[model samples]
Target: MQAPTRTARTAGVLFLLTFVSAITGAALYAPLLTDPDYIIGPGADTRILLGAVCELVLIITNIGTAVVLFPVLRHHSETAAVGYFAARIVECTFIAVGILSILAVVTLRQTAGPDAAEYLPVARALVAVHGWTFLLGPGFVVGIGNGLLLAFLMYRSHLVPRPMALLGLIGGPLMSMSGVAVLFGAYGQSSIPSALATLPEIIWEASLGIYLTVVGFRRPRDAETTGTGAQESRAPRS
Candidate 1:
């Protein structure tokens, strides 16, 4: 048993941050975005602001995962690491756009009376933008990046157990299928099937976060063989 290097510890924390911020952001925004009354009625300013702030933090953490892991991942596959980073960035960009769309609703609500004829349609459009952003961002982009590329890297590198990584690998395609289904009007994004499709990915991410935070990544063989750095304790075999 050995201690994880400073970089591994940092990456572990970043992974946890990514998980927490994403979940918290969704919870914070769900209420404001789902209720039509929130868009039409007054006194949602605070909620809207809070939602926006959470989204911003989500963006930060989303990027943090890739950025923090890049160094270690690059050692295994530089191309994949860069691709994963790019994918996360793309996901965050779409999410940021979605946040702006929802924020537009807040701005519109503040400016227009609930009963105003122009209010409902414009608000609906804004919400639609946000909805599409969600699909494109989390449903598609995340499946491609976080679920697939990240899992592939971790699997090859043995950063986490292969089974845990397999969950993500399997989940990614399912999520992508669901995203396509949503795109084609086969089902709603919030449908049970969609949730089920994403469940493996969710579990993989959460488990990965917990694993990294608790045990950190296995020391790369090069590092171990060279005796160039502090040897990290290996995560338990699953």
Candidate 2:
């Protein structure tokens, strides 16, 4: 039905948004991880710019995802619905981090007057906020939370292709674990272990994005419509 097509399109968009967001984070901040004291111009213009760009992408993507997710809920199983809502909440938090951190970055960039440590206050604050949000907040807290929900939801829902649902289930736990690794790495608790952790997070994003894209655009009718129709479909034979 038309609904399936529309839902599929939205799923594609979610994939696009998340994929781009990942790229932005990797490209921009990865450099900072290597060099803590690196500066662009006077007070680390390069770092601030990178941070802003990443956040900007996230802001736009989260907004897009939020728009599509409402329609998306209509098609999910109860457990899937729960997982979906949890992901939405996580997305919102990510957006909040993007916005707040961006503001902090811009504020420092503007106010800084060649004091090497000038940007540190704002940047550190923003980074600190980011540290909690992305690593502690989204990665560990929300990521794991949603991952578990999605995994459980996928297990319970019979509407999707078994393979696809199973894929989602598999990805969910991995994603949560990736978040944990990312958190540990971001906090600098363990060097090699933390570095190892990020690989999975990125992989989880890519893998999940790929699965959603494939399933969304295919326009295949899975348990979503079957379940929907059953609720609305009456006992005409009786």
Candidate 3:
């Protein structure tokens, strides 16, 4: 078999970066963020520091996906490619804002001391900022950028299997809709329904990363034919 092309290798790295960042960031933030006492509790400093690190990774890799894929994707559709890249940038910006909010909470916790209760309101507000950023960045922004544009391009180009691409096609809109529902107070963000709504997208991303890493995309027809011809030429003849 032929070695993977530079484009394929780059795609693999980008996908893996997104996969790692998503999982690690969420893991670091979810439990602590969910706890009401997190801001006032012991180890709050360490937890917030970890959250900051994770968000930073997410911000960088989120934009990296668009940057790495643009060269190849643009060849297929320049308009869509640029749109995806821009959307990713927006997503990353919101994530960075969220990180700042988390840091603010940490700073307050450090200085408030015995008067932490007095500053609780401000901490909650900062947490709310992070929550809104999460909703907008991974929830809505991903729907437009990673979900719609990325999947559509892959589907159109036959870069990966159509069924795999369909996951993003279907999941993206659902996630975005769910995000809107949360914004409107349709359901709690941490509720079971919310989890179910987001599951497809989670699977879509995980599958995308694995597929790109292991399968490394489907080669164009002409390239496959050329590879086969070259192999046959190198075979021993009678």
Best by TM-score: 1
Give the candidate number with the greatest lDDT. Answer: 1
Residues 31-71, model 1: lDDT tens digits: 66777666556546776678788778888878887878887
Give the Å shift of residue 153 in candidate 1: 0.7
Tell me the TM-score of each prediction against the true structure: 0.86, 0.64, 0.85
lDDT (CA) per prediction: 0.80, 0.53, 0.78
For candidate 3, give the lDDT of residue 160.
Answer: 73
lDDT of 3 by residue, 23-123 (tens): 67777776557766655777457756876787787777777778778887887789999999999999999989988888887788788888888877788
24-118 per-residue lDDT for model 2 (tens digits)? 76466644433444332334446546656676666566556545544544455554565566565666676577557655655555666576465
**For model 1, how big is the CA root-mean-square deviation?**
5.6
Q: What CA RMSD would you report for each candidate? A: 5.6, 5.4, 5.5
How many residue pairs clash in each candidate at the backbone level?
0, 1, 0
The regions of model 3 sitting more than 4 angstroms off are: 1-4, 30-32, 222-238
Candidate 1 off by > 4 Å: 1-4, 113-115, 220-238
lDDT of 1 at 79: 95
Candidate 3 local lDDT, residue 25: 72
Q: Rank the candidates by TM-score, best first.
A: 1, 3, 2
